[model samples]
Target: MGSEPGAGWEFARAAAVHSEVWVITRPRFEPLIAHALAAEPVLAPWIHPVYVDLPDWCLRLKKHHRDVYWYYPLWQRLAGQRALDLHREAPFDVAHHVTFASDWMPCGLTALPPTVPLVWGPVGGASYVPVPLLRWLGLRGAAAELARRTVTGACRRAIADRTARRAQLVVGLNDDVRRRFAGTAAVVVEPNAVVDPAARGSSGSSAPSRVRTAVFVGRLVSWKGTRLAVKALSHPAAANWKLEFIGAGPDQRWLEAEAARRGISDRVTCRGQLPREAVLAALDAADAMLFPSLHDSAPWVVAEACAAGLPVICVDLGGPPIFVRGTADGVSRVVDVGPGLPARLAVALRDSESVQRPTPSDRWSSARMPALLEAWYGQAAQFRAGRDAAGNGSSVSSEVGGLVPQTP
Candidate 1:
């Protein structure tokens, strides 16, 4: 598992439960892992950093110095081939994978040493649509409809292609992503983890804002559909709303400029990147969340919003709808941007859920996430054991590697 800021947190948390965990982090983030563990009691002993020489999309931080993305297939193709060799040399139990920003993936799993099985963990999360883009394009009627269809198709294709390759058993965070891989993979639209609402200070409200506050958190990229959100503030219905954004990425400069142009600069506030807890706290104060993504899987933000009971304004695009129920109550209109988008959003926001958002984790029915993942893990291990017993060279090892221990 290549180390990432988010992945570091996930791996460390999971390690506390699963004793047989080994972490392979890119060389650049070794300090980050050490620093993170030093601060968190739960992660102190279970995570370790291993150095890998080859880098590509999988290990972008280390390999990007050479600008691997500039030259596509050459480095990437070799990297995929190299992954197989590395596993063969250091054969392990099932390969567990969880990714959000997956630019590239190893093509074939069947050809790996027959002894090892590669299992998909939390596969893909949703992308944040840049709200600014929709406002810039002002796409309406046929133009917005076409754009919506293209993005919807792209999202489906992404799910289908991914499921076809790496997943033996794909765990879905929501029903929508699960539907995309329904026939191909063992789809589980269950969340892998749960949130204890009482554990946190507060989430948000289902009731519409008494104080007109909104939150948007994600990367500052084109597809996030954040542009549309900013423009929405300038719209007649949302004139009173004040928004706080918590995130940073490539398009920060451009997005800020767009907000200023729309004459809602004072209403829109960009908080840059805040800690995870801080972002949640911001959500707790706001009346609703605005997630206008074009293409995405199941967005954790949406789950977080729903779990918090904060009404959300999400396009009925791929991932957003996974958590968004509809505009009826406690949720946004699930707006689909087309001819009538701005007009629809205008009307919907007026009747938006104004009640306190009930914490879904505390009061809702079962999504059955943990059980589904545990089942997938067991099946993956069993498959690996069978392969190794048959003397397949690529088998996940029968014996466990002694728990590597160190200070947190």
Candidate 2:
């Protein structure tokens, strides 16, 4: 129950504060959910878990990477049917698709009763690597990106379009996704990272040191731009900065080799995977986070870095920029993705060397999410009511006041 499933669980807990939550998930997670509920019995009554899975014969499709897409749609159909059956027994006011937070993916909740307002995403997947930056990724990575773009483009017009049109409110993970569904649906931008307030820690204590530590906390994947970070470390602009790589992947060897090749191996450290508490402790000690992910919708590390009051230096391309945007100057840097990205990243690294950490903001805090969810649910209901009043012909503006500001 980590990553996407963890996010779904958090949403259920948050929603349970206001209404009963029926959480539809895979059967494998039932034990984990039960354990979690046993620890916090108060939420047990409000959170109902409904396990849904495809037939045993279809399980093989889940084995392959590409085949999972085929399996997902089939699973959605089954989940939708199950939802329809449950609706007959107990009606729902709002249906939200939480996990698989991608705009191109179809949501089963769309099959809910038309009278029940649907909330789709804090989702993203519309962002892409710039052509020039694609060279940073190896040929295999580049081809994968191209294929993904093709698939996403086709799905956006077909499956995603239908889902967006069916949803009463579309909550985009970033502005790019909001723009993608802008004309077709009522869209609002919100990121998916929800940090615990207790995780907030003091930063900037290490800023004045002659040498600065920039940590990259994520899977060492090709598309994560770890190679670029390593290359930047060798640049004279970032001479004083050392990099720490957390998390593991196939790219670890390449990342290490690249650092050695660039003559900055001494300054680079690969810690592999660490516990969540250790990761937070690392964030508190580091001067900044260097997450130059090419097309990540919302990397949770960025929010965690913010919660630790650590500055973030990420590319202008995806949810990272959205998370760091409104902070005080020097608190974060969003480098543009194009030719000379490593050089530009080096400059950002140099610039972040002396900046004091910004105070942790409540923007991405979980404490604020319940109120935001309440507002989003209210807005979804209003949109549904307005559509019903206008014979399903009118479109309501997706704007709402007094909530956390939408992703800029």
TM-score of 1: 0.66
lDDT of 1 by residue, 176-267 (tens): 54665667666655443333333454634443435477788888665676666776777878875777788997667766898788787888
Q: List lDDT for all candidates, in order.
A: 0.55, 0.80
lDDT of 2 by residue, 104-173 (tens): 8778877777777888887899999889888888999999999999989998888999999898889988
User: Where in model 2 is the C-alpha error above 4 Å?
Assistant: 198-209, 326-330, 387-408
Clashes found in each candidate (C-alpha, N, C closer than 3 A): 35, 0
For model 2, state the Cα shift of residue 232 in Å.
1.1
TM-score of each: 0.66, 0.90
Best by TM-score: 2
